[model samples]
Target: DQQVKQNSPSLSVQEGRISILNCDYTNSMFDYFLWYKKYPAEGPTFLISISSIKDKNEDGRFTVFLNKSAKHLSLHIVPSQPGDSAVYFCAALRGANSKLTFGKGITLSVRP
Candidate 1:
């Protein structure tokens, strides 16, 4: 069974708006959460992450919120832009050197 899931397959947002992506996990042992963005024919690029000890982490326009009790997490992008259009994935890790478990991914489309 898949431990991480992204229920929504896609999302659309206008330029300069906010884009919110969600994810859920079934493993309680996961101690770290990460978000990655990918474009067609390219590898995923790390975006942001949060440790289970913290509730939130932010970088520039990207922010990640984790609700440990609920086994849920979300990524928020403020002032979304056309360049932000890509496949976003949620990933979880148990410890250093451990492989990351990733969600299928959600495609975000930013229209002008």
Candidate 2:
């Protein structure tokens, strides 16, 4: 089973601070990892991703890190703004299906 798990269903952070979200997986074969940001009624947009070959990737205020041995990953957003408040989903892609296996979804509240 390609079950990707997000242990926490929600997180709250203050504006201008760091927000960290975590994800775990049981499948070692999963080589491609992604984090997607979503709003109510809208589709998720790719935020940041790290290939199995790399340990970390970053873009602007967002960063992602992968630990293959632990089968875990995390997303970090620095100076999170109120605009960053949204549901974040951790996803993985492997095998023939480029289709992503997503966590149940977690709502992140950024308080101003």
Candidate 3:
């Protein structure tokens, strides 16, 4: 079974709007959640992260929220910019291991 799921494969938003990317995981062992953003022809780079103990974490225009009970997590980008358009992946790690399990990336398009 797929441990992580991104129900929506893609999301589009106009510039200066809020963009929300969501993910759900079935494994209860996931303790640390991360979000990665990837540009065309580039490797995915870490964007933001939220630990299972915290409900939310914010950095600049990006924020990540985790609802452990629901096995859901979301990334919010405020005033979405065209430059922010990319394939975003939700990842989870258990017990400080180097390996991370990732969900299918969700392509995000920002229209100017």
For each candidate, what TM-score against the reference?
A: 0.97, 0.95, 0.97
Which one wins by lDDT: 2 or 3? 3
Query: CA lDDT, every prediction?
Result: 0.97, 0.92, 0.94
lDDT of 2 by residue, 1-112 (tens): 6489998999999999999999999888777999999999999999998998898999999999999889999999998999999999999988567878998778999999
Weakest ten-residue segment in model 2 by summed lDDT:
95-104
Q: Which regions of candidate 1 deviate over 4 angstroms?
A: none
Residue pairs with backbone overlap in model 3: none
Q: What is the lDDT of residue 5 in candidate 1?
A: 98
lDDT of 3 by residue, 1-112 (tens): 7898999999999999999999999998887999999999999999998888999999999999899889999999998999999999999999667679999999999999
Error of 3 at 68 (Å): 0.8
lDDT of 2 at 8: 94
* Model 1 score (lDDT): 0.97
* TM-score, prediction 1: 0.97
lDDT of 1 by residue, 46-92 (tens): 99999999999999999999999999999999999999999999999
Selected candidate, larger TM-score, 2 vs 3: 3
